[model samples]
Target: MSSPEHKQLIWNLIKDIKVGMLVTKELNDEDGLRARPMSLVQDAYDGTLYFFTSKTDAKAFEIAQDKDVCLTFSNPKDNVYVSLTGKAKLSEKRDLIDQYWNKWVAAWFKNGKDDPDVAILEVKISKGEHWDSTNNKLVQLFEVTKSNIFESSTPNLGESKKFGTE
Candidate 1:
């Protein structure tokens, strides 16, 4: 898909999640992952998810080592959730930080970027898959009820696992 479309899908699914469990690798152990609930930091729909975090955090250290992080946003009420896994880049540009900073973020930015703990986590979309149930429920029912009859009038979006690979 095109870049704008790709970014939109991500923004729509993850934006409402507000707070999500972020899965980042543990620097001490490659096989270990550290998960935390954060008020999902984000930037504009430019195909990259930006998160405001501390550079000294364990999760940050892991990203620095491999840049691969998984961010999950699930709405229990809607039963819809999306998880994004990708490479990350730490940015300290004032403009980028200012664009995303809000009154709530003042506690961290107050000390400024030079603060040993301040940093931005930028995740590059490598591949992402989301379950769009509002559109899928009817189709799912049809498939189950007509398993031996008519089928496949609409393709599943979850089937599209190809993005950023080409």
Candidate 2:
């Protein structure tokens, strides 16, 4: 079980990250992996990540065959990167979909929130790692310079931690 503090840390790392790369195994492709960008549906973290997709989407079919998936979120500017491994399941719950729906989403689904093809992809996170670093450019440059001058193997780049179950 993940501690509440760890959950909060995960949320803090990803709250502003609007998009993540959802990676899944490619069906009938000889152990290949396919990744696609997905917009985050929720602003707050709750151990599960949610995304919107169509029931007919290839990703949905792939998830049905293999639930194991990974989501990666990165922001080079802030030097924050996160990778999460989880099991994915598809849902057609209108109430849940409606909660996350917005005008931007409607652009993709012409039929709006009630679109029959609409589906929600829920990722129950098993484990995740996050790296967060200071965003100041000068601080980053100084860290690099200091590392070189001191012949240090470690640079003051960021903090990285692994959370959730093993």
Candidate 3:
């Protein structure tokens, strides 16, 4: 079963959201962590994130040793933000790669889907949390007027070790 609040948070942050930063720690622990913007695939509900990648990429190598992964999605215009945690791995589904293939991809990868390096990076999300910049100005004003409503209106749905207000 999924909590309405948690499910809503995920939908709001991901359903129409296009891009996010996927950050992974290096297995060497030699100050080699990495973060890159990605065209996010849909959440599989089984707690995983799917990313377009290549077989020989450093990201895949990192996942090979350290499976843990975290992704961040933020809307600067709305001030809404989400942090997703999971484990990452490379997938061998050629059909899935061809599905996302397009002209733009052709421009970037030359031969496009035919590239031998192409692969999918899948992240199995264990949990996620969000901080939403409330959309209702009237509601915000009401909260300010009531003073205590600030704590009531904002919802923190995940138990990340660190929480942010902005």
Candidate 4:
């Protein structure tokens, strides 16, 4: 599929997931990588993902030193998973923050939109890959049994695709 089409498909699959695991490089730590759950700022995906974060948070500091980041979205019941690689930067754009703000966000920024600590993290995606599978229990059981009994062929586990430009 075309790049635009693939991006649209990815957006469709992940927009509803609402939350993703944001991975960033660890600073001065042996852990190497640190991942934390972040809520999506908007439902419409356009190769850029946004999240609200504290300006003083470790993630914000980490991204400042190394802009490269990864976001992973998954829905076990639907058997959909997506991993996106991107570059991120912190923004204190109040207008952008206001546009994405909702009641759920207010809980974190008790002082409302003017909260000094509130910041927006924008991730410009460079590439992504996704996995989708038919995870019905019956289908899986049959496939597993068939694969074991037949021993000549493997079951159709799922579809995986890589999309986006470098």
- CA lDDT, every prediction? 0.70, 0.88, 0.68, 0.89
- Compared with the true structure, model 4 gives a TM-score of 0.91
RMSD of each predicted structure: 4.2, 1.7, 5.8, 2.0
The window of 10 residues in a row where model 4 has the poorest summed lDDT is 1-10
Q: Is candidate 1 or candidate 3 better by lDDT?
A: 1
Give stretches of model 2 more than 4 Å off. 145-152
lDDT of 3: 0.68
lDDT of 2 by residue, 9-120 (tens): 8878787888999999998896899999999988777789898999999999999999999999998878899999999999988788989998878889999888899999
- TM-score for predicted model 2 compared with the true structure: 0.90
lDDT of candidate 3 over 1-166, digit per residue (tens) = 2355555557666756768888888767877788988876554334456667877777788888888778888875665678887778898788877666666456657656778877778776667676765445655556566665555553432233322221
Q: Each model's TM-score, in the order given?
A: 0.74, 0.90, 0.70, 0.91
Q: Per-residue CA lDDT of candidate 1, range 1-166, in tens?
A: 3378777877877787777777887887858888898775664567677778887777777777877777777875564767777778788877777777776766766686456667777777777666656545676656566754556444432333335553
Q: Which stretches of candidate 1 lie above 4 Å from their native place?
A: 108-116, 135-166
* TM-score ranking, high to low: 4, 2, 1, 3
Model 3 regions more than 4 Å off: 1-9, 30-32, 42-46, 135-166
| lDDT score, candidate 2 | 0.88
Give Cα distance to truth, residue 118, candidate 2, Å. Answer: 0.5
lDDT per residue (tens digit) for residues 1-166 in model 4: 2366777888888989989999999989856999999999887777788999999899999999999999999998888999999999999987889899999889999999899999999999998889998768678778889999999978876899887676
For model 1, the run of ten residues with the poorest summed lDDT: 153-162
Task: Please give the clash total of every predicted structure, in order.
Answer: 0, 0, 2, 0
